[model samples]
Target: MTPEARKNAVRWSVFALVGAVITVSLLFGGVSDFHPTAVVRKVYDEVEALPDGSPILISSDFDPGSEAELKPMMDAVLEQCWRKNLRVIVMTICSPNSPELADSIVRASADAHGKVYGTDYAVFGYLAGGSAPILALGQDWHAVYKTDRGGTPCRDLPAMKGISKLTDFPLCLEISAVSTIDYWILAGNAKYGLKLGLGVTAVMATDYYQYLATRQVVGIIGGVSGASQYESMTRQDALRKARETKEAGDLASARMPTQSAIHVTIILLVVLGNILYFAGKRKEKASP
Candidate 1:
């Protein structure tokens, strides 16, 4: 066979393998009720134990670039919060692009849980100056969040009552795609002593585990795998609540199998390409 035929054969093999994996991914993507990781469970349980009407803060520190990885985490956490009837305040800290992203995600979750804006929840939009805003946060809620993302006076938002500073919130969940998590750790957790949990990209997980050792962080929701785990646990919790009135066990359809397959396919594709490149190099060296 000619060299061209060999190249075609290798390309077709890779394509076929990826197609097979995608098929399997779709077939098993909907699996549920599986066990969650310890890190993810700690986060779920901590929020689960909060009393109804307890207020907490969630800082979404990612952009659209990270939506696929972090949005699921945000959704699962918000579902659990609303399931327990917890009051929430949403914000975008690290990523300037996240205000609209945060707004959209929270809006959907609020609607799903029949939550009322301004009363049950509020969205504080983006502020410039990088992590400098963290220092300004607890000093004056009104000065920092004078208005909601929609330009409504925060005072009109019933949810803003009793929240003066960062410490006013007993817990703050930071879901991020960048080093914003580190900034929050230093400013939000270490400086103010506020309790911190995280939902970070898979790559960021390893770097932040050091904080977990010191208990500086409560727990972590690391990437899509961790997000799926938390969603499973949330599903179980929802099941025990009243079926019609309470939150349903229906977490968003699982993304685990498909996400995993896509990740694996990408790795395999890179490896196959490298192998074929080397094989071709050897063939060229051997040719007359």
Candidate 2:
């Protein structure tokens, strides 16, 4: 090959190599036993300790753009709640994307745990008008979510049978990419006195902490790392009495694996590019 052509090839190869290394490193980091913060631990512990069959509202206040951080957190929370046999009520107050994203995650997570829809959990889906919808929930849940996402009447769902208002729920967990905490605080918690919790991105964690300190929120699980922490907390709680280490260890493990795989694949591409670059250089030097 021409010298110029060969040089261009080597440059591209180098770029590829760097990309690969970064990818792999990130992948390893994701699976690595990254420690959880005190806040995360508190969040997990509170949720885990809730009485079985306790109802909790999980609001998927996220869009496609923020799914990366929010999705994993949602998965982890759902898994823990399902394992503990919590009655989850999924809803979305802020974004239009809430219904689809929240429903997808809940259905998948529930399926994994063999949770029957309308019995084990019920999704109220996206309620209209943000705070308006939330406030309506305080007055009467059936008024807002007369039917679930599947078009089944909420009154007919076993999960919604006795639950009429927000306060009836033992806990309310809002998994939001947006800062819609105020609506719930104003409508649900302040009005009816329902216990509220938050799962927000790391960026939002700080602000939520302030809310938590004020007792506005019972707990806050912030970011993907926080989700991983919850996973660990779940495992610990599940096997607390089990003599076998494996059973206990299985708890809190991440239900999300795609992020790690993507990181690893990127790293491999980077490493290969570097190797090809060096190999091509050596070949060029050896030739006339």
Candidate 3:
């Protein structure tokens, strides 16, 4: 075959293989749950140990751009918190759209677990002043957020009863996709000694490993794969809960198969491309 024809054949072949893999994986689960990483396991274990009615803060610092990757993470975490009967106080400092997104996830998870609103969970809308807001929240939550997204006073909310400051909560979870995670570490964790667990995009995962190594950050769920791992852990917990009562299992990791298929397809294409290039180079060298 001519060089042009060979290139076209290779390209079409790759497209066909990738498409098939993605379709099959999505239809029937492709990715198997591997062993949980240490950081992810720590996050799960900490949440698991929290007693019922314990208050925890979840800061979602991502916008719609990162919704696909971070939303599942948020849902899985919130579901676990609800299953443990923990009071979830969710807030956002990234975008104006974040509060609504956080609220929807929390409400859906709470409803699934038959948890009450206002009592079991509360979402304080976008807090202004960037790091300043986080600093104020750490010192005095009421000073920063007097009311929730709905305009109800924080004092009136049953979930915010004993939560006067950031340190009041045992755990602070940040589902972020930007530098907001750094802000949380510096302003909240460094100063207030707040224990933090992070759910960051894959791209930002490596940047924070040093924090985990230093014990500055308690745990991390990095990217979609990490989210899937946590989901698997949460699913096992749900199964145990199911034995006692009818409860839905975690579905946040359902997309793992698709992600895995795409990754594998890309890796195969890379190897194939490299082999073809070297083979063509050898043929040219032999001819001349």
Q: lDDT for model 3, please.
A: 0.83
Question: Across residues 11-114, which tens digit of lDDT does each residue of candidate 3 receive?
Answer: 89888988898788766663345468898998888888888889999998888898888887888788788778899999999988888878887788788788
C-alpha RMSD of candidate 1: 4.7
174-274 in candidate 1: lDDT tens per residue? 99898878778888888889899999998889898888879899999888788778877665554334233433323433556566677888897899879
TM per prediction: 0.82, 0.74, 0.87
Candidate with the greatest TM-score versus the true structure:
3
Which pairs of residues have clashing backbones in candidate 3?
Answer: none
Question: lDDT tens digits, residues 77-168, model 2?
Answer: 88788888888888887777678877887898799889999999988666668688777787888887878988999899988767888778
Residue 120 in model 3: lDDT: 88
Residue-pair clashes per candidate: 0, 11, 0
Each candidate: RMSD to true structure?
4.7, 7.7, 3.6
Error of 2 at 278 (Å): 34
**True-vs-predicted CA distance for residue 186, candidate 3, Å:** 0.9
C-alpha RMSD (angstroms) for model 3: 3.6
